[model samples]
Target chain A: MGFFDKLKEKLTKTKQTIIEKIEAIVPVGKKIDETTIEEIEEILISSDVGIKATEQITELLKKRVKEGALKDYNDLKLLLRDELYKILEDNTSLNLSNKPSVILVVGVNGVGKTTTIGKLGHKFVSKGKSVVFAASDTFRAAAIEQLEIWANRVGADLIKHKSGADPAAVAFDALEHAKSKNKDIVIVDTAGRLHTKFPLMEELKKISRVMKKSIPESPHETLLILDATTGQNAIRQAALFNEALGLTGIVVTKLDGTAKGGVIFAVKKEIGIPIKLIGIGEGVDDLKEFNPKEFVDALFD
Target chain B: MFEALSDKLEAIFKKLKGKGILKEEDVDVALKEIRIALLEADVNFKVVKSFIDRVRQKSIGKEILESLSPAQQVIKIVYDELCELLGGSSAKIQLSPNPPTVIMMVGLHGSGKTTTSAKLARIFKKEGRRPMLVAADLQRPAAIEQLITLGKQIDVPVFHSFDLKDPRKLCQEALKKAKIDRMDPVIVDTAGRMHVDEELMQELQYVKEILNPNEVLFVADAMTGQDAVNIAKSFNDKIGIDGIILTKMDGDARGGAALSIKEVTGKPIKLIGVGEKLDALEEFYPDRIAKRILGMGDVLSLIEQAQKAFDQKEAEKLKEKIEKEDFTFDDLKEQIRKMRKMGPLENILSMLPGANKLLKDIKIDEKEFVKVEAIINSMTLEERKNPKIINASRRIRIAKGSGTTVTDVNRLIKQFNEMKKMMKKFKHGKGFKLPKIFPF
Candidate 1:
């Protein structure tokens, strides 16, 4: 199956909450009305597209309706597609423009941070790029071993430290090793859950600074992997990481789960960070470049 | 999506602040706002409808509360109904009078079954019970190792086998080992698939049959929103769950699952994983969750004054100062310093209703607090006593001394003013702004 088809199948759970509901409301050629717009608004919010983004879409739909441009719910779908795409406009593509680019993966614990890094490494290896995996998530138990297993499977070199070692030191060593080995990419896997309950993770900041010591332009892309099923709290997680690390892109994972992953629009709308990828399944092939058109299309499909 | 629910309510309440007599239309507007907020937060539409009905019945044209404003009574009614929807009271983990209360942790992969199993052990350990972690999740490549490692950190013993692949057999042996070791609670971390499938369910059924766990915690991710509810229902129907453990709770604030899980699946959320650490687990309280739903957490702290035990004289003086609108940046700085020493500033700030709005909107952390602390400490005694005496050059000096940006210094003073404004409302008992402030 094609990637989009796979995404569609995986996102069936997500689609259940969105397209299914919308289609049920505005089938084939139903005329749009006030109640229809309200139902559509509720659907958008239910999918976690968020209030602001949903309001933006409804606002546009209302304007179109007022202008006599939207005669039916069929026209409403086109308007939503246009408005949703606008929120995701940015540097959405992975910036592989620089060789030996350092990719930093960060997220809260249990958001598949390590798995996404492993999957990314596998993708790079398949594309004929020499990749080195950094086990900077040394705080999480057996995080190194888990990454090491992925490294071995993908034929990528892994730079790791003993469990519980300073994660920043591991990241720094990995960058130095990647540079020395002339690796095409260095994937730095930071611990998702910092030991400190304190919200500010100086360690994350410290790691970024230490990587610059190895390569001034290290960490070229810092991608935050968020869970697809997350609700309003996704904003808090995204804001913290985005503010602290100045995140370049975002990847919403576990799209296979029964959630439209509408928080994607929320993150983009609230933080203005382009979502670069989506994780639809557990396999290495599940990570796909986030296409806004395709994503919003899939939401209604 | 996180604060969307409370923020909407806050907006509505803000409008209703000085409306002495809330007309039916006013209540209608508030209910409509509440309905949208709840639905937006991913609360089931049916549940939201019923909740609105309950709040409307109690609040519409109720002139009984003479001391309280109409908006305050409406919020109180909604809060009480929300609490009822959230399982009324906390349903704690069912501890067996007999030792070795088996807790079978089951959920989808990446739902945090293993880590929460460890967290459960830690919570039980804090209660002086010997908890053993059973690594039944041998399906994942390193799930066993992950559980064992988490076990070591928490000083709990882990039972896992290299050869044993069948979780049923592994759990049986682990239960026997727990009994032998006199462990009070044997936590069995079961394997999880990407989605609910028959094989995984049957295997869990086997393990559940063998262990006869006292509690089968359906570990669900809080971020999953409504999906968490459906997954919980699936698990509860297929394998039967005694309760739920909502993970990554601190990540998102909407807590749609917290509302939906109990109302839809008929299962209480026993605990919540506030953070990733094993010790990050907190007992789920309906009152607290309800207050959070209404954005009343900060108002609770402000009204309860549990932290007032720190300095009674200072507390009384501060209350009087706030009532008389005598609060200043000096008092603000001192209160923040004292609050930081007492507990997390969010908890202290969350006590004040408006503080939550400001904190939620602003990206402040401990590092900012450090900068705030340094800026205050750098000030002379006079500056500390009277922040009004400080000027731009003095701010630059303080920033230079503290090694912080001017924005940091500015934020401190700005936050100080906001605190004073909010505290004045709290002290007067004039029903503060409906949405953000405590309904006094």
Candidate 2:
């Protein structure tokens, strides 16, 4: 299947929760009323669009209804599609102009950081760019081995150190290796850490510094990977990670596994970071380059 | 967006608190808000709809107590409904009379099945079960290696085959090895796959037949909102998961999956994976979860934590110090470290009434306490006992020793001194005040 079909299929549960919920609420020829608005508000919040986004959408619908813009219940679906699409328009493209443009993948452990690194490797390699994998997540015992297998599968070079090594040193070595090899892109994987942990955040900063030491403008993209299954908790993560690293983009992983796709809108609305990609399935090539229109349409359809 | 999941629930309740005897309409409004909270908490849409309907039916026009308002009645009903929806009570993994009670871990990719498998073995091992983990997750490269490495860390035996391509045969052989090794409970960490893929489900079915696992504990990410509800149904239908293990409970997530999965799949959540640490698993309690989700302080879980984390003698001493406002930097460092070890600070603070409001937006990082430890460790005994003795040069020495900038040292000292001042105020029992120590 193509990326669009795959994303649509993966988003089936999310779409059912969002679109089907609305359809169930608004019967045929039902007039828009305060109760109807309240029901919509509840649906949006439950869908994980979050409090602020739900309130905004509800308020917008109310105002538009007052203005006679939404004459029928059907109009509300179109309005929701527009509202959600507008928020998802962040990070439409990546800046791949820099040779060996480094991308740092960071999140709490088991949010698919290694898997995403592998998938991104496939994406770039498919584009015929030389990619190098950096195992900076030296704390996790299997992280290096996992990345090694992924590197081999995707035909990317890897630079790693033994587990328990200082992660920043490994990052420095990986960058230096990338420079020597003249690779087109380098993806560095950092140990997953809770953003609330200041010490771990400090560890991340040290790694970033080491990368810059090797290449002045390295790590051009610091992408925060989040599990879509999580609700508002993902927002707090985005906020802290963004505050700590000024994240350039976000990759919402496991989209196929969540009914809270509204979380995508919540992250964008809260952090204002564009979702650059979304993992639709377990396949290495299932990472879809995020298109807001397609995503919103899939939900509303 | 940064609001804690409880903050929204509390806000709706708080708005209701000021009103006099509320009408049936008021109850409807609150119930609607509660429904929204449940959904936001990641309850399934259909489940939320039915839940709200039931609560609404019970609440509307019902004669509330003279002492209690409609809001309290509604909160009680919602809390009760939440508990019921979360399987009524905690469900422990049922052990079979037969030896080698098999536990097959299943979930979608990134749902933390592998880590949870190791965590479960660690927990059972602590309980004196000769448990072993089987690496059947050959889908991801080195996944078997991952499980094995985790096994080494926790000192548990891991069964795997580097050459085995068929997961079922590998599992069968592993079961044989487990039986020979006298493993009481063999936890099989199965390959992660999408629920939509029939071939993968069949793959799980094949492993299930070979193992005939006694307990099929489905590992799920707590962050999974509505999808968790549907996924739970599919897994239950396909492989018959006995219980759900909600992973990533350490996350700031409001935990919709925990609330929704039980109602949707009719299965109890047995364990919660709070952190990535090997021992971060906790026996799931529905009442505690309901209380936390509904903005009610979870005192039961909090006391349980205090009991597990500290000795009775230590707690008594700490209590005495706090009562007397005689906290030293050493005491502060010790308490912070202990609290950090207990789990996320938010989980702890949720035990205190009204602290949820403060904790909702707060970023409580245990790592911040690590810095405090560094600063305190750098100080002299005299300085630790009497902070007034530390001069500017001494501060610089302490900062250098701690490998931190002087500014960090300064901030720590400032916060420390401020906490002291607050404790002194608090000792006088003027009022209940919570310090705004957030975003650490």
Candidate 3:
């Protein structure tokens, strides 16, 4: 199946609920009133679309209603899809200009950083690009082993140190190995840490800095993996991680669950960090490029 | 964006403070602000709607409106409702009358189940119960290894079979082993799975049927958004969870998921995972969490932690030294050590009322504590007791010994003297200020 078709199928639960809730709130031929608008707002908010983004979308609908552009529930639905799509639309490709381009994956504990790296490795390997995996997550128990399994599965070379060793050293060694091997990409997996932990954040910064020692302007892409189930704190995660590492993009994971991944809209609206990829399932091939138009159509169509 | 719900409520109530009597409109305005704050905290919109409706009904009553200090009354009503909704008080895991009580941990992917299972085992071990960990999570790569590693760290035995692919069989065998080994409260760490996956959900159901776990704790990330309700409801429907465990509570997330899960599943949050350490598992307190969600600060938890960290005898001796105005670098180092025992300084500070706003601008460098300890350790006994004896030469030597600059040593000495003076002033019934030696 095509990635879009798969994404639509995976997101069917979220889409059905969203569309079903709106339809249930207001019949197709019925005019959208204040009560209908409030109910729609609740549906979006409940989906983790967030208060700010929902307000923005609702405000636009109200404006369209005053201008006589919005007539019925169908018109409101179409307009909502378009506005949501507009907010999510952005450059969703990786910047791989440099040889052995470093992609640093960072996030709070349990957001699927290692699994996403495994899938990303599969993608690059499929494209005939040589890849090196850096198991810099030297904190979590068995984290390195987890990444090692992913590396072996995806046909990528893994450079790891003993658990509790310096993560920066692991990243540095991986970059060196990738350079010596003349690899096309290096994926650095750091330990899952809450952004509130200052010492851990500093450690991540140190890893980023040490990468520069091997290749100037290294770590071309610093992606923060956000769980789709995360609420408003996704914004905080993005803001802090961006401030600490200048996050280039985000990879929202676990979209196969009931979560609408609506927090990404808030993340994009507030932080302006584009969503580069969406993890639809637990399988290695479930990762797909995020397309805003298709995602909206999948929700409404 | 990081505004605590308490700060927003404070702003709203500040306007209502001068009003002699509450009007319906006044209550409506307050409830509106409360609704927004709750929603911002990631409370389910339906839950928030029902909650606001209840609070509004109670707040706009004739007696409440006519009561003096109606704003405080309204605040009290809201606080009570929140506390009640959060399970009234802390709920303890129900221990089975039979030995080898089984606890099955279930949650979506990345919810800290494996880690929390080890923590739970550690807690049971500390309570003098022979607890065993069962690695039933056969899905994720290296998950069993992770559990085994954690079990080794806590010195608890982990039951696992590399040959067993079926979790139901694995759990059944683990339980039989636990009974044979006299291991009570067997914690089964299940693989994290999406609730929408039917096959996986049915797998969990079969395991649940076989295990008949004493406690089926639904582990969840504290930062989970609106979907907490759906996930909790599905788990409760499928496997019938007994309680909840919210992980990563150390983060600054408002943790509305706790409230949402409690509301949806009617399951009490039994414990919370506050840090990465094996001992960081804490018994959940609904009042403290309610206060945390309302942005009112968790003073109760802070005090409990402080009491746990500080020795009463040591505190009495420190108090005597402070009264005598003879607080030395040795004493300061001892206090710092005890303070370190109470989690991170930033985390402790965050429990203070209005500390979130204070912490927003100031970066608390935890490494400063290490530096202070090093500088103090570098000091000789005589120099530590008598700061006057530490001359420029001694300061230089100490700086070199501690691998710090002379300026840093001088600053510490100066601050130590200033703190002594402030203690004296405090004894003399004057306002006291903390010494600026440590970075905020």
Q: Which candidate ranks first by lDDT, i.e. highest?
A: 3
lDDT of 2 by residue, B1-440 (tens): 11355677778878878887766777777777776666656667678888888888777664563546767877788788888988897889988798889999999887888889999898889899899999988888789888999999999999988998999899889888987888979999988887767888998988899899888988887767656766788899998988899887776666777777887788889998876678778888888777777767778877888778788999889778878767788987787777677876765775665676676566556666677788889998888888888878988999999988788878877877787777667777776565533326
DockQ of every candidate structure: 0.34, 0.43, 0.80
Cα interface RMSD of each candidate: 3.8, 2.9, 1.1
Question: For model 3, how does the per-residue alpha-carbon lDDT over A229-293 read when each residue is reduced to its tens digit?
Answer: 99999999999999999999999999999657688789999999999999999888989888888
Ranking by DockQ: 3, 2, 1
The weakest ten consecutive residues by lDDT in model 1 chain A span A193-202
lDDT of 2 at A49: 83
Q: Model 3 off-target regions past 4 Å?
A: B1-3, B426-437
lDDT of 2 by residue, A1-301 (tens): 7767777888888888788988888865677877889888877877778888889999999999888888666787788788888877655667688887989989976788999999999999999999999899887768899999999999999998898899998888888888888889989998888776666888898888888898998789999998886666778789989888889999988887566687888989988998898988787888888888888888876
lDDT of each: 0.77, 0.81, 0.88
- The segments of candidate 2 whose C-alpha lies over 4 angstroms from its true place after superposition are A1-91, A256-261, A293-301, B1-3, B57-62, B68-72, B310-350, B358-440
lDDT of 2 at B25: 76
Alpha-carbon shift of residue B272 in model 1 (angstroms): 2.5
Q: What is the TM-score of chain B in candidate 3?
A: 0.94
> For model 1, how does the per-residue alpha-carbon lDDT over A171-211 read when each residue is reduced to its tens digit?
88988787787889999998875212344366788889899
Q: For candidate 3, lDDT tens digit of each residue in B1-440?
A: 12466778888888888798898898888888988888988888888888998898888878696787898888788888999888998889999998879999999999999999999999899889999999999999999889989999999999998899999899888888888888898999999999989999999999999899899999999999998999999999988999999999888787788778899999899998889988788888888766765567888888998899897998899888989888888999988898888887777778787776887776778788898899999999998898898989999999999999999888888888878888888888798775665655
